[model samples]
Target: MSIAPARIDEQTIRALPKAEVHVHLEGTFSLIDLLTLAKENGVALPGPAATLFDISTHTDFETPEVTTGGGTGTGSAGLSGFLRFLDWQCGLVRTPEQAARVAYAFAARQSASGVRYSDVIVNPTHWNAWRGRDLALMDALSAGFDEAEQDGLCRVGIAYSLLRGQTAADAEDAVARLADASLRRVVALSVDGDEKTTGRTGEKFQNAFAIAASAGLHRTVHAGESSGPEGVWDAIDLLQAERIDHGVRAIEDDALIARLIADGVSLGVCPRSNITLGIYDGWASHPLPRLLAAGVRVTLNTDDPAPMGTSLEADWAVAADQFGFSHDDMVGFARRSLEASFADDDLKRDLLTELEAVVTASTAAEVTA
Candidate 1:
């Protein structure tokens, strides 16, 4: 006979101390902050400030494009609409002050959602061109990181991204900048941008990855997000990445799955982003559960909170409601993320112990209740 389904309460889910292993820092800018920064920077947006964050209208997932005359541009329709929203984001945050504000707001939001630590991916390429000040962008980013950390809301880490379409020299420069920033303990070096723009395999990014690795920075790549499992392999073999972002397609390759598990490489999984982008039909069909069952270490995150209409808590809720992940399973995911994180040994151990206590205590309390 079939067994009864497990019961998951929202309180238990929310009470689980969690950590975000992948998130785009700029992508986390709340609608209110975005509009405020836009107004201050004199950038013209399509609608009133209030409408920018309106979940109902904005949630109608459409493809993103550069709009003129208040009309959406034609493009690959999907969660990319949210990515298009980010294209317009540069104009709004053109100063160091704005960047710090974005960081603060993002940390506050994550803390409220039960996140104890977060690794925020920041694309300096966008900010460098937008600010055009020749100032130390990495220094400015460190300032933001410091402010977020000082808030005591969460332990914050930064990942610098190299754009895929950039020239080899440009990629080298991005890596050099990241290497210099690594002196201050930025977490990892990431490669992002349009996969098609760089031919998916990203031959030019190798030198950048090499430089980052030489500087003792961990490496991750936005692989298998737009391409297939082969893209994930290229990132592993070609770039020597220590982790992968949106590696859902890895399930398609038995050899790759075995290699990933054997090597202990982690996959930063974003469930809602997958659903919004049509990578998976829904949470239940998402490969995350399968990946986890197969012994692949996976961590959940909100790729773009505003555009994707999700938060850390909401993503966890989906894992419960759709994937049937128990509260224990969700806590296990968080603990694994801390262990697999790019954080230093001391911090990782400390956070792991804290999370274990939280999980153990919460589980006992649930049993008593």
Candidate 2:
């Protein structure tokens, strides 16, 4: 039997098959993984080990003080600051084995959150240790993910990313190497970083994205977050982006919102990340529900779950608890993520079938209860 979308139970939302298309592998570091990797690599902690990754410094969710941003371009406050943190923590990897372990752990975490498939972003710029060995890096990550897939963990594809701070030459060089690498795990060519710090970059990297497209890699861009709606326009028009990461700022331009609806481009949105980074005031002010109501394809995600202390389910809870979204609205968001993923059609179909059955059972349980 089919399930109705009226019930807003926690069990059904937790059980629904999910797809995370915007998560960063650099940001998936759990406290245990951090310690294990630190010990293995002899990386010193910048502060007290126990509270090094605390959310208090990163967010003002419960406090009365209005903490807008985190750090500077070189520090840890705004989008620029957060990108630097990603670079710092991601540098702990000293070998292919370490890279594999990170990828394995990423898939396992996603599986724990009911994510059946994921497209994880890994910017080579962040991994200083893996410098000159990106091909081997992708291979290592793919090997780990392959092992996880064998064990029924979340099936993963890598969205190889270039930091926005890189030059046009850097973009060209990265794409050329990826085109020649023949890595099966590399699914898309993505560009992410602090756009506000870099200014307009679409015109500069247009050729690079074209090369990636020619090489059969999908295109995704991080825009409409650090910058304004103009950045998103550049992503779609110049970069030919198939999907956008953190395109929440599109709400600023009604024309852009209509364009997104017309072009059918899905956005991978991280609501909590926005709040932590000082983009939005709080959950109530987030643009997620409005974006959905406007007929825009919005996919729920945890942008940097570990550092932000959030999960896919936690983001969905924002829609339910904060916005009073019905179960149907929440399910629609989950389904959009699955549909937006770069995963194979067969896998997506299987995941959708699983989702249907779980939702049906959960709905029935809720009805009887």
Candidate 3:
């Protein structure tokens, strides 16, 4: 029997109100935005940033070693290409002002994409060292958050991220900075970086998690993306994350799946990021459907709009097309996202009501026409 294709209109899907739970602040930079920022900041582009945005450019798989340590190392060639791309990105974002500019532009672009609310991950450790001023880095990022919220384009929140390579002292310092109630925009603390750099050992950043939890901040950790389902367990057992980012691999273990369902933990599911990183061969083979069907609370997001060439709408389409999700399923995903969001109860209820109206109107239009 032939499989049915997912029926979703790109334009209509773009109009859907959605909450993005796993987007990275720096990762949202579009190729056009990156180029403009580079020129405005007097930074040089390695090549044309625009070319990376071209969907037609087939990655050269033969020359695997041309690039260094980036991309989806699923194949030798893809890994090399990713590394080269990372080098290009690193070259462009060198100062605090550049980071702020990227943040402002990213919010504008995401606003245009119809995202009503978003919680973006920000890692200041690497950028701080890059700019050689810890206080300056925080101030610049805080400014970006203030500007985005004031514009009323979207309700923005920050997840102050801890790098995997940081020492215990580094984590302590990060927590201390976040403990300051003056930074009211920061809603949570997260761990993000090379997963291998910080495993389940819990020695490096355990104190950081404790600090965040004590400060009444939400906790999220990146696991099971590069590692397997065990990484998911480690995050919960060690870091005590209320949510797991890219926890798709949790499907590998039955007990783990049961725990996730019973505990009501949220998974920040990024379908395009998985396919681009070779976690799943393609969207058709991704485990999002299985997880959702199994009663796991899954929310959609764009890990990086520019790097992975995806948006929140594109992610919903992938779910519909690849997983055979119905219109109700799409609405359910949106509701799940809002429920899992860090937004206050009042805002959450309001967004859910608005989303219900959107679903109703779309369904009514389809039925009438």
Candidate 4:
């Protein structure tokens, strides 16, 4: 008789070892943080801070009109409205100290979900205050996360994002700026923003990605989220992304799916966000299961946890419940997350060791029973 691995239940999710690779700093602010920052910054509010992101209860994202004026996130549905909210929310952090607070909060929040490390993407275009002082902004964030490290919580790596519509010159400038030694926490160069609205921009930033590759920085591109399979192809071909964010749409093309597996490019998938933003009708229709079935290297993430109202562990549970993910599947996804992250080799090894301990303990317990 063959012995099975320890069974994974919902509670096991909290004990699972994982890392988050696609979370955005702008959209991860907690409601309490938003309230505190609004009070400290004297930002004008449309209503009470408690109900700021509670404006919508629906899940369809058919609207093309961008949210305008003082509307509290959810004025319109889909990616455009979410981008506008990110702009408004990020603007609340007018000082370096506030940015530090946001970074610290990231460690604390991910810790609760048992995430060992997170590679956070922060698009500079969303901020107005630190428009010219890029290094200073990162310095502040690094300081905050460093403080959290003392507590032994989740470690963080910063990835600066280039908005899709930005010119190639802007991409060049971003890569050049990121190369500075003072920006200590930056590990990867990323491209974010809505691909549908910005259209095809892989060619525009191709040179910048090439520069980043030479400079020893990792490349992550946001593709197949708002756009289709063609966008994903550009990421793999032109930009040569090490990982693709929100790549659910890659399922639309069979060749694209094969390419992702052949090229060993991981996709950071956010199932809850996809449904909440109406990217799909519901969880059943999500291509995540299909992608996994096709042997794609996919990892679950909370793209914007606070804004989308989901957590890393919660996403795992949902996947387990909806997709019939077994003990091995969840464990394998956790392993994939660690392998796919930009974390240093030492940290990755240490975390992987801890993961094995969790598994071994569970196995021993089962044997004793």
For candidate 1, the 10 contiguous residues with the lowest summed lDDT are 66-75
Local accuracy of candidate 1 as per-residue lDDT tens digits, 231-305: 889899889888988788899999999989988889988878777656668766788888988989898877777
lDDT: the better of candidates 1 and 3: 3
Model 2 agreement with the true structure over 114-149: per-residue lDDT tens digits: 899999998776677777788888998899999999
Which sections of candidate 4 miss by over 4 Å? Answer: 1-10, 55-78
TM-score of candidate 3 against the unseen true structure = 0.86
Query: If ranked by TM-score, best first, what sequence of candidates would result?
Result: 4, 2, 1, 3
Residues 219-286 of candidate 3 have per-residue lDDT tens digits of 98887776778878877877888998888889899999999998899899888888876788997788
Instruction: Give the residue spans of candidate 1 off by over 4 A.
Output: 1-10, 53-75, 78-81, 128-135, 181-185
Candidate 3 wrong stretches, greater than 4 Å? 1-6, 49-97, 126-135, 201-203, 364-369
Local distance difference test, per candidate? 0.71, 0.81, 0.71, 0.80
* TM-score computed on alpha carbons, candidate 2: 0.90
Report the C-alpha lDDT of model 4 over 1-369, residue by residue, as the tens digit. 978544455578879888999888887888888778878977765445666776343232222232221101122354444665666677788787898888999999999888999999977777767777777888889989998888888999998887776789977987887775636798898887666556788999999999888888999988887678898999989997999988889999999999999999999998887778677889999999899999999999888878767788888888888887887788888899999999999999988898889988977997999
After the best TM-score superposition of candidate 2, give how far the Cα of residue 337 lies from its true spot, in angstroms: 0.7
